[model samples]
Target: MNKLRQHSFLAFLCLILILPTLVFGECTCDEEEDGDRNKTEALKYKLAAIASILVASAIGVGIPILGKTIPALHPDRNIFFLIKAFAAGVILATGFIHVLPDAFDNLTSPCLKENPWGKFPFTGFVAMVAAIGTLMVDASATSYYSRSHSKNNQAQPVENGGDEEKAGEHEGHVHVHTHATHGHSHGSVDTSPTTQLLRHRVISQVLELGIIVHSVIIGISLGASESPDTIRPLVAALTFHQFFEGMGLGGCISQAKFKARGVAIMALFFSLTTPVGIAIGIGISNVYKENSPTALIVEGVFNAASAGILIYMSLVDLLAADFMNPKMQSNGRLQAGANIALLLGAGCMSLLAKWA
Candidate 1:
């Protein structure tokens, strides 16, 4: 009888422990059902944001591509130099002001452990590495292509009988420019076609890489946020962001003179990366913790690398190349105009940082 009593007591204790779980499980189910309803409501906002994103993107990218039709916007026009300069300034500001700071924030977030990340500025270090790597790639690529071009030129003899007629007529006066990067120069007119083509190819590919990296990141970040208020402004800013960036990229592509197929492929790639990123964010929104360590690390690293590439490309390839030209140096008014444009571009992009 005493053992029987003990068994009853044990069962009573188990019931007390298990009863709360059973009650809590029902509450959990109700909460989950409510959450589903909330999520469904949230979808309405997301769809609107996405639609706005597409429209803004279309406007932004279309303008630059259409600039070819505008008389003042031709690549050879003097205004084009100033426009490119302004775009370069915008890119530079983007690297330094926007992306780098965000990277620092991410890498130094409190969520990340303190031992390694907090000890030093990983943002700057990663950016520096990326910049150095870009330089190496830029130099090596130019060398490889230039060498191959030279070899091809050598193999194919010049037309008009070895081009032996009247060297003085075209000597150093053909409106020919090198645009050769990384210690390469266009010394001989005997082989300019190959050099020009190669330079354009390099510029187009590099520009795309830089722009696409930044765009996808911003797109996903915008899409994944739960706050509708935040998404609204970003929709506008990012639209303009893509437009200006598209213009910059379009300028490079236009200069590159790519084939129809190549141009379309590049344009489409630029357009899709951000949208794709947004979709990815939406799909992963359930498990994607914005404040999580893994998310911070990946985002921080990519931002740093992107910051480096844009900084280098803007300063070396865009600003310096155009600013140092005889045309710009000779015309004070044009120089002033370009400086103003630079400020405008930088200001526009800087303001957008609030949302995106």
Candidate 2:
């Protein structure tokens, strides 16, 4: 394990050092003198993007969480499933339409050499590996927590068992209570609400990680651009993008039932990440060339990995789990409604890709 950690750290360091050299072909650093009007327009768009995305994200997340107060939006209702299906579709579209395409464009840019870079499909490969890695982490974490919980439960007798055992002792019938206790233990081992809740928590955290990575990268790109034309359309598109993405994340976080503090932290973090990335980009814009080999490689790799994680989580954890549930399967009308909602979400998000 130690060796594995060491190797992983070394690989990360090497990537950081080597990314700048991936292409020596050309740098699209246009040094054209833009008049003060252009500068003012760019600043206007940048601020607009920041404020719009921030408000959109906050409203998106807040709606779902606050929806708990509305009976119609309760998790147990069919409407909730439809909402979740829509959110899952948005996430699926984001991974496939937004992040994956960006990854491919970056890795296959004309600026890169045709030797080794063009020889292999790094974008697809990285995405595949990242998806498999997420599965492994998901499986391992679930197993570890389940096993630990089982062991802890075993170490302590059930509350009912203690009362039954005491009665059995008083009545000189300990064997009867022992047998009943065994049956209860078997049932507890088979299924538990705590275990299910823990799994949701894990899914929520991993999903947030994937979403935040892509969000920050997009923000940086938007911030670094000096082109007012490019920034103009992006501001509107990314506002909608952040809003939909936040809804997806909010659903997961609501299901996870995190503490008040945890929910606040996550919502704030999601709301602030894009703005923070933009801030970082503005600060480094003088040296941050978007077309630079380092920027391309890092952004491409991260985007690909994020795509994989989001896709897997959307398909396996969110959509499949809900679609296959007894509640959904039993109600054909509900299922059909959810399917339509899913398509609508995917279509809306896909359309945004045209500009973003």
Candidate 3:
């Protein structure tokens, strides 16, 4: 009889433990149905985001590169400097305000295991490594190209060299006088201009790589989301984000002076990347869980790396190069104007983070 009583108590204990799960399972099913309803509403916004981003990207890129035909937007103009300052500020804020914080959030998310992710600051570590990698690429590419250029220049015959040198020198002298008449000098155009132009090309390519990485990820996140309220504001904010970012990239592309075909291809590529990513996200949304462990790790690392690349490029390649230009330094008014423009651009981008 005593043994029978013990069995009854054991069964009751099991019942008590299992009852909450049975009730909670029903609640979970209800929540899942509500989530589905919300997700269905969000689908409409994804379509809108595609169109908005495509148009915004095209217009933004086209404006600067095509605007080259405009007198004020010429590379030599004070207006161009201000435009670059604005663009640099945008890129800077993108790294700091947008991508970096996102990285921190994802890497430190509770979904991740606490053993490694919580124990170590992986986001920062990845970012620092990424920054160093970018510097290596920048330095190595510049060195390799510089060496190749010097070799090619050396390989030319004296006869060809003499004629080319004469022509190059004439062009350089003309450039100096032209800038001088505009109240500044572009430094020695004979040698530095060629090297500078090459560097610009490198910068454009690397900057695009960094920007594209984040762009695709952002698009995917947007596509995978099932919240209309989350996506709605992102649509507007990302639109502006792409627009200003395109301007930054366009500035570099314009300065690089790539062939018309190259520019067209690049512009198209940039415009398409995010939209394509969105399409991919939509396809995989059924299985794509944003807060899942694998997704968080991948997206977090990529975002951190991208942030590092942009920060490095903006500071070292874009802002520093222009701010230290002889022309900008010579004119105090221009310097002050550019500084204000930079602040305005950064402030605007930072504000967008609240919604995006």
| Candidate 1: tens digits of C-alpha lDDT, residues 194-250 | 555566578668867977887778777866776556666766676677767776777
Which of the predicted structures, 2 or 3, would earn the higher lDDT when compared with the native?
3
Task: List runs of model 3 lying over 4 Å from the truth.
Answer: 1-37, 158-164, 169-191
**Weakest 10 consecutive residues of candidate 3 by summed lDDT:** 170-179
Best by TM-score: 3
| Candidate 3 global lDDT | 0.87
Q: Is candidate 1 or candidate 3 better by lDDT?
A: 3
TM-score of each: 0.79, 0.83, 0.84
Error of 1 at 183 (Å): 24
Pairs with backbone N, CA or C atoms under 3 Å apart (clashes), candidate 1: 60-243
Which residue runs of candidate 2 sit more than 4 Å off their true CA positions?
1-35, 160-191
Of the candidates shown, which would achieve the greatest lDDT relative to the real structure?
3
Clashes of 2: 0
Give me the overall lDDT of model 1. Answer: 0.75
Model 1 spans with C-alpha error above 4 angstroms: 1-42, 67-70, 164-197
TM-score of 2: 0.83
